[model samples]
Target: MAVATQTMTDEQRKSVALEYLKAFDNAGTTSTGGSILDLFAEDAQVMFPKWGLATGKKEIGQLFTDIGGTLTSIQHHYSEFTWIFSGSDLVVAEGTSHGEHRDGPWRAGVPEWGAGRWCDVFEIRDFLIQRCFIYLDPDYAGRDTARYPWLSQD
Candidate 1:
């Protein structure tokens, strides 16, 4: 995808940045696919913190499909967002991810208390994420597992 050079105003940039984030964050709650796709440009990249990375619309669509088929939900509350514009089309979003898994506490990615406070750095192009880097504190994951005490074998 061709990155744009339109030069958005500071406010417009922030607006676009928020929209870009809402696409993914909302996916964790009420998005099936279309809602999530709305925030992406035709070519986007979606990555799980430590699992997978899908590039382009086709790949991203499949990633969403896989997410829908396997895990029941992404339930999350996004707060503490800090956004910066790299250029007209590129943006980086740093925010804490906190949520719980309702159906299965045994799940690895799912947590008991919070969503592990992750930082997702998104490379947004044309209003969608073209690349992403997910960062999460393993200590939080460990703590969540510790709370349950039945699933941690390590």
Candidate 2:
């Protein structure tokens, strides 16, 4: 039996990765009615550390919606990204994200607000996101002091 898959050039892989990031940034700031989900294939999956695997568009959309509800604002800044092409259809992009999240309660006397880092791995196929595995310190949601003790002005 022969396995078949779609193929994308190196430039196409890079473009898809960038486009996915742009769509994510736009989604965070707009009300486009599930436009974020448009970046994924029909059977895409998202896997996060604590969030298990969200399969298909509906589940994935619900996952993002739930996460969006937790913060008033959030932003992902991709500082570095390294791409690896597996076969012609699979491209794995790994990167670190400098991010900010605010407007919640995650600590005993502190509002949930902090700037942290994230490590993400994205799998792209045919110009769409096929899978995304995100790894990060979810505990960083608490006091910034926990993660940024050097910021003290004392």
Candidate 3:
């Protein structure tokens, strides 16, 4: 497998992270499977909240395809991030996603929209994503934001 041979500067790491986010943002409303998968290493793995774990490109791509069918639109708006670099080969990004979801609840007889929190852990290798684990409240999207005093002034 190809490996990252050099260390990236903090600026470079941040740039790569942003690119990943951009690819993800672009993935929301369309089926640009390659565009979304291009940011990951060939053998990358992702531990998603509802969808479970996916290993390798094919599985990961399939995960996106499956989830894409359920959502009309979605976004990952990271409210905070902490990046730690272990040399140039590895980077760990921890953050909270304060994103929006539409046509959600992803099931029949459920609320149709969501705006809530997801905690994410992203591990990067050679500037490509090596692993991503997201923890979230699967039901958060179905409730009214006004019910959460922290989310609204209601």
Candidate 4:
């Protein structure tokens, strides 16, 4: 006997990733009408900058809670997003965002390097994300400039 294998087209994989992003952007709102965890598998893994890695939904919930509690609002630029596909389970999304953090607000291209830019790598299979790693600068307010003298004081 042979077990069945699941396969997803590139578009299907992209759709799953896009849905994940939409859910994230709509977090705390009724727009998505579902928890973001619904898009992940039972044993999904997520990683974020500064927050580190979280395996399974319970830990993932904690990670999101910690990060979400710090942000007043966040919106990803869907039109400006660049999607890359590996023809497998991997999908990468690079985009800009504008949002208000507890310290202040941030917009893409405002300071160029302060914040609002991010990249997320996802592995989606069976219509659920198995692994997602987020890469970005957590300093939404750009308050860490003291360490870098190159930043303008203005």
Top model by lDDT, which number? Answer: 4
lDDT of 4 by residue, 35-57 (tens): 88888888899999999999998
Scored by TM-score, the top model is 4
Assess each prediction's global lDDT (C-alpha) against the native: 0.54, 0.62, 0.62, 0.86
TM-score of each: 0.59, 0.66, 0.64, 0.92
Q: What is the clash count for each candidate, in the order shown?
A: 1, 0, 1, 0
| Better lDDT candidate (2, 4) | 4
lDDT (Cα, tens digit) per residue for candidate 2, span 1-154: 1122666677786676666665665654234344777777888888866678999989998888876655544445554566676655556665544334454423222332332445556667666778877766554454445447564433
Writing each residue's lDDT as its tens digit, candidate 1 over 68-146 gives 5443334334345676766555556665544333433232335443444556666554444556666654343344565
Alpha carbon lDDT at 41, candidate 3: 84
What order do candidates take by TM-score, descending?
4, 2, 3, 1
Q: Specify the poorest-scoring 10-residue window by lDDT in model 1.
A: 99-108
Instruction: Report clash pairs, candidate 2.
Output: none
The parts of candidate 3 lying over 4 Å away from their true place are 1-3, 28-34, 78-115, 143-154
Score residue 129 of candidate 2 by CA lDDT.
Answer: 78
C-alpha-based local distance difference test score of model 2 = 0.62
Of 1 and 4, the candidate ranking higher by lDDT:
4
Ranking by lDDT: 4, 3, 2, 1
- What is the Å distance of residue 113 in model 3 from its true position? 14
Candidate 1 lDDT (Cα, whole model)?
A: 0.54
Cα lDDT of candidate 4 equals 0.86
